[model samples]
Target: MKTLYETSLKESLAIQKRVIGALLMREIITRYGRNNLGFLWLFVEPLMLTLLIVFLWKFLRADRISSLNIVAFILTGYPMAMMWRNASNRAIGAISANVSLLYHRNVRVLDTIISRTLLEVAGATIAQIAIMAVLIAIRWVDVPNDIFYMLLAWLLMALFAFGLGLIICSIAFKFDAFGKIWSTLSFILLPLSGAFFFVSSLPIQAQKYVLWIPMIHGTEMFRHGYFGSSVITMENPWYLLLCDLVLLFVGLAMVAGFSKGVEAR
Candidate 1:
């Protein structure tokens, strides 16, 4: 009897793995099928955007860029924010994009959403790493003293991104125009993300305000790793960690609340 139960359990595990694997492969291939560059564009999109910003800013600042020497600041800030943006935004449309696939008994909602998230996250991380490498090689940016903290910082960023993604994915299922709302809100939120400038560069009160935004903390933490200096004066590692946890739970709650209805659809 125990052997039979064990066999059953193994079969179930194998089934789940097969489902997830198929979904992951389908999601990746589906993305690349549209374009010749395929996966290359994933890296190119963010890389070009970051480089364009750097070039324009450098030009606009002219000699002043070297004075402040904030290339590392931009590199750190932009990629961290972009990671969250890409992951969550892709997630927002994940259900809508792949709703047909959900009809297949083997293609579970979790598998579908996760496949999308993994593609976006993989693309975002690679883009960030490539840009950082180029900047460092060109002497346009400085290196981080602590690899461990940078990894921790990045891991936290991914958690926050995934949390936000889950929440958005939940909403995208039930609402008709959630995508539009998400886009508009993100436009408004971009200025506050601290991507273009350091939080410390803001006025004292503004500094306090920006620190309250959890996304800003991710940037600050990553910048700290890179520069060996803190970006925001109000550095609370614990607070940031707490914020990530809250967002993640909130996301999970939203998913749990809406998952039944979603499956019903």
Candidate 2:
């Protein structure tokens, strides 16, 4: 027989799971509609973006920095970055967009943000797997040397993205202007994320500074798995894990503080 506290906790968890699932379905239909591609666009959107970047880099980047396959390099790096970037970006205005739903006692601001972030992460993950499969089939890219490591890296990045979305969603709720400019600020920060370049490629002094950015660590760890012993990488899984924990703590606190004032008009 479960204690009353345990029973209540279990019921809360079940309700939250159901609420998030419903929010996810609503988001998919609202964003994509029931037209042609519809919910397929969840993966297709990221898939197309990754393909365009891969092709553009393959053709236009006249200089070859490494002997590694360019397609493989970008494929491994960009989609992972996109997972976090797009997730955090969509988190802006999440409360406002789904404010009406919050009128329901069980629906919450966190649920809205989580649903959006999860959708972006899911889309990017699916796109990365599908593209890797197609490229491997055609011999355009080699099989990853350590797939488990890649999965771990991807999972860490997704957690980081979720935490980031929560923080960004909290901030955006408080400041409408900040929400508007985050896209631009995030764009400026994207290159520094190590999406397009290897951390080992930087000067020894620069590498230390670049590694301070949490996103770079995930990118490096991911590429490390894909390239194996062929390349050098600098990624401290503990450091990124620490950042994820801090972000989640601060984000949840902020959300709890602000959500009270967010009445549905």
Candidate 2, residues 157-180, lDDT tens digits: the string is: 999999999988888877888877
- Scored by TM-score, the top model is 2
What range of 10 consecutive residues in model 1 has the weakest lDDT sum? Answer: 227-236
Clashes of 2: 0
User: Model 1, 39-133: lDDT tens per residue?
Assistant: 78766766677677768877787646356456666667777777778787888767666777777776666666677777777777887788778
Candidate 2 yields a Cα-based lDDT of: 0.86
Candidate 2: list runs displaced more than 4 Å: 35-65
